[model samples]
Target: MPVEARYALLYSDYEVTPCLRIPFEKFAFLILTLPLCAFIFCIIYSVLFHFESATSTHCHVYNVLPSISAAIGNFSPQREVWQTAIMLQSVPRFYIAVIYLQFHHAMAYPRDAWMGNFAFLLNVTENISLIILSFWTSSRHYTVHEKAFITFILMSEFHMLLTCIMQSRFKRHNRRSLKWKRRLFLTNVSCIILGAYCYMRHNSLCEPYMYSLFAFAEYVVVLTNMAFHTTAYFDFENKDFVLYKYGAAITER
Candidate 1:
């Protein structure tokens, strides 16, 4: 069958399903704002404890801008603050995974296409990997932490790639506003490239600046991921998911 016909059948099935649908705006807000706030809090928390006059001499000046993971490690004297910041960050990640899965459902892509389902899977996997890395301090579980970090990066990139592909196929009316999507895609790709370079420089050359450079790259990656979700605001501005009340008829708002 033609792609349009397949999409039509899938959408028809979605229309009859008795599940509650949420507004994409809600998801977009969760995806974009929460993470931004959480990261900002984490950065501030990290910077404050890192530069304390009491600890600065023992911790070294370079330690002031340690990798985000290092800043949030369990060994910090401010472990509680760092852990709290990490937990706050994780909330948005969890919500992002949920929103991506919900988005896949809302799109009603055919099973055969599989891109939507796979994108959700990758997104969830990325979140899980990050969660693992967050709690499993690198000082104690270096190998596991490193593996989880790498896995998160790989899965996140794959998730974004699939998202870009799927978004490109949006109905004609929605595709026009996706110019920003292309720019975001490029930004993501550039971050990955720059991040890889910085990582290599830090590991191979032991360059002092490369450590901070890599950390900044990681921050950019997170920001770009958040930006990717912002594109949905344009695509779903007018459409909303219907919420079904328990023991009551479904109604669209």
Candidate 2:
């Protein structure tokens, strides 16, 4: 069967203007903004109100920024804001994952289609792990939260790497956006390494500002990850998210 015939099976022959249609750019904006605002809110709230606990570590080292868990785990409004953001963002994220899978598979060709699908799986697992970690705070469900966080980090890093690799293979696939995505992926990986080192050193020596370095690195990792996702805006620049009634009459404009 032809591709058009396959698509036709999913939709009716009638034509109608969508009741709700949002451009991918606008949708991507929401995807980018929610977490960013939550991150900023949680960090500022932690610094201003929950300073001692937020920046504290096992070794009692002084810190500049709080770890993501510290900022959003135990706090009241901070936790709530973070949870709300994640919950809201999750729906669009799943949609974006499906879109990316199709986009990658179609553009990269069937020979490497498995890579695209695997990347999609990684994206979904990463999102699920994020949701798990957001709800299960280390202060409470320590083991569960820790495991979820580790999974989230691993999945997120690998998803970014795989996505960059897939994009690099497509000769005409938005080279400028791919350029920034690859750059951000490298920076994200660097921050992850730096954060790990700082965390280990802080625990071993109980240094004054080592935990701060870890916190800063963690923040950079998050920022770079967000920036990488932001490239999706360019990826689907002309696309629209539509919700239309399938059998509705086509009214003349």
Best lDDT goes to which candidate?
Answer: 2
Each prediction's Cα RMSD?
6.3, 4.0
Give the TM-scores of the predictions, in the order they appear. 0.69, 0.90
Residue-level lDDT of model 1, residues 12-56, one tens digit each, is 433455455566567567556655775666666667765443123
Distance (Å) between predicted and true CA of 180, model 2? 1.1
lDDT of 2 by residue, 172-251 (tens): 68977898999999999999999999889888899898988888898999888888888987776665655455521111
For model 2, the run of ten residues with the poorest summed lDDT = 2-11
Give the local distance difference test score of model 1: 0.61
Give the runs in model 2 whose Cα sits over 4 Å from its true position.
1-16, 245-253
Candidate 1 accuracy as TM-score = 0.69
